[model samples]
Target: MEAPLVAALGALIAVVEACGAAVVVVGALSGGPARRARS
Candidate 1:
């Protein structure tokens, strides 16, 4: 009972961390192009 709940919470935390990393990576990649365009 409690074990399953703990596992679910862990998975959710992992997913959120992954998504945050992905967003940071995408933002970094796109920012380079925008900077070039500005120059």
Candidate 2:
């Protein structure tokens, strides 16, 4: 009962963190070239 709920919440948090990291990585990669070009 409680164990399953805790597991589910942990999984959800892990997924969200992974997604956030991916977005940050992608944003940095996409921004890098533009920033270099401007300079």
Candidate 3:
């Protein structure tokens, strides 16, 4: 319930969301072509 703790928690959530988004984008980009090749 402190300001610094709240700020840090928000920052951590943002970082996690960003990393997850990047991973999804990269996976989709790589999978699209490879999936087509196999099919």
Candidate 4:
């Protein structure tokens, strides 16, 4: 039981970190274009 719980917690933490990285990448991409095209 404990092992399964630990695995689940670790997986959840990994997912959150991955999502945060993805969000940061997306924000940078969007901001770059918007800034460059600001006529």
Candidate 5:
């Protein structure tokens, strides 16, 4: 019932947070290369 729905929502939130963290790491890693190329 409501419990299952809540659990699903929580799982979705965790996945979104993980994706955001990965993006940040990737952006930080690539940012250096991009800046060097521009310069």
Candidate 6:
């Protein structure tokens, strides 16, 4: 019982980290073009 709960929590953490990384990558890609256009 407890083991299953711990596994689920670990999986959730991994998903959150992946999502954060994706957001960072997208922001960096989009921000570069916008900055260049302004300059």
The numbered model that scores best in TM-score is 3
Instruction: Give the per-residue lDDT digits (tens) of candidate 6, residues 1-39.
Output: 899999999999999999999999999999999999999
In candidate 5, what are the lDDT values of residues 1-39, reduced to their tens digit? 899999999999999999999999999999989999999
TM-score of 2: 0.86
Q: Whose lDDT is higher: candidate 3's or candidate 5's?
A: 3
* lDDT for each residue of candidate 4 in 1-39, tens digit (9 for 90 to 100): 799999999999999999999999999999899999995
lDDT (tens digit, per residue) of candidate 3 on 1-39: 699999999999999999999999999999999999999
lDDT of 1 by residue, 1-39 (tens): 899999999999999999999999999999989999999
Q: TM-scores across all candidates?
A: 0.86, 0.86, 0.92, 0.82, 0.83, 0.88
Report the Cα lDDT for candidate 3. Answer: 0.98
Candidate 1 vs. true structure, TM-score? 0.86
- What C-alpha lDDT do the candidate models reach, one value each? 0.98, 0.98, 0.98, 0.97, 0.97, 0.99
Clashing pairs in 5: none
Which is superior by lDDT, 1 or 6? 6
Itemize residue pairs with steric clashes in candidate 4.
Answer: none
**lDDT measured at residue 27 in model 6 versus the true structure, 0 to 100:** 94
Candidate 4, which segments miss by more than 4 Å at Cα? none
Which pairs clash in model 1? none
lDDT of 2 by residue, 1-39 (tens): 899999999999999999999999999999999899999
